[model samples]
Target: MFFKSSKINEFRLWGLLFTLFGMGLMILGTSGIVFWGQAGKWFAGVFMVIGMIAMLLSVGVYFWAGMLSTSAVILICPECNRHTKILGKTDRCMYCKTKLTLDPNEATDLDEGITEKA
Candidate 1:
């Protein structure tokens, strides 16, 4: 299991965006002030509902990521093995900073330094 700051940051960014969007919708829904008469009123209500859903989904994702972070296995890279966590897809060795790939074929294509015995 490896945790990368970049990936974490990416998740955080998405979570924040979702929450903000959701809040915006909720506020609009509550306000009930239409910008464009009856036609626009329906759209506003819809946006608010969708925003609420997005916020809820984002919260779930944040929780899931946190759980995964705690459960992931830690390994020392043989090449640059400095205690890095590997997640799904592909990861890099933290110590020597070797790029790690999940797929054996892709790893082979990426670099000769990569070994895919696992």
Candidate 2:
């Protein structure tokens, strides 16, 4: 299924995944694999560095996404009657994928999100 959420939500998800991946790498580095035994200290240090980089990237992404969210507009979806955040004038409902727009004149039924009553 397609991702059903606001753009900001998508960005946050990616950042969170990055954080989890970093955590995984850190765990692997410290897991004490036999091959790493020869230079375990150096190996662990490298892994820790890589993991920290990933974690830092995640934090930056999260901060940027959150900052962008501050400018997003929250609108109530007509289809689902739910509050949805819209960025850059056009967006879909987070719950129902209903296409919405800041420009009312631009709304049309040809799109998937907007359903016209027959």
Question: For this target, which candidate reaches the highest lDDT against the unseen true structure?
Answer: 2
Model 1 lDDT, residue 81, Cα: 40
Would you list the C-alpha lDDT of every candidate in the order shown?
A: 0.67, 0.83
The 10-residue segment with the lowest total lDDT in model 1: 1-10
Worst 10 residues of 2 by lDDT: 109-118
Task: Output the lDDT of residue 84, model 1.
Answer: 73
lDDT tens string, model 2, 38-82?
677777778888999999999999999989888888889998998
Model 1 lDDT tens row, 11-116: 6567788888889887777555555666667777787779879999889879876777786656676675477766666666534545666567666552535655
As a whole number from 0 to 100, the lDDT of residue 3 in candidate 1 is: 42
Stretches off by above 4 angstroms in model 2 are 1-4, 33-35, 104-106, 110-118
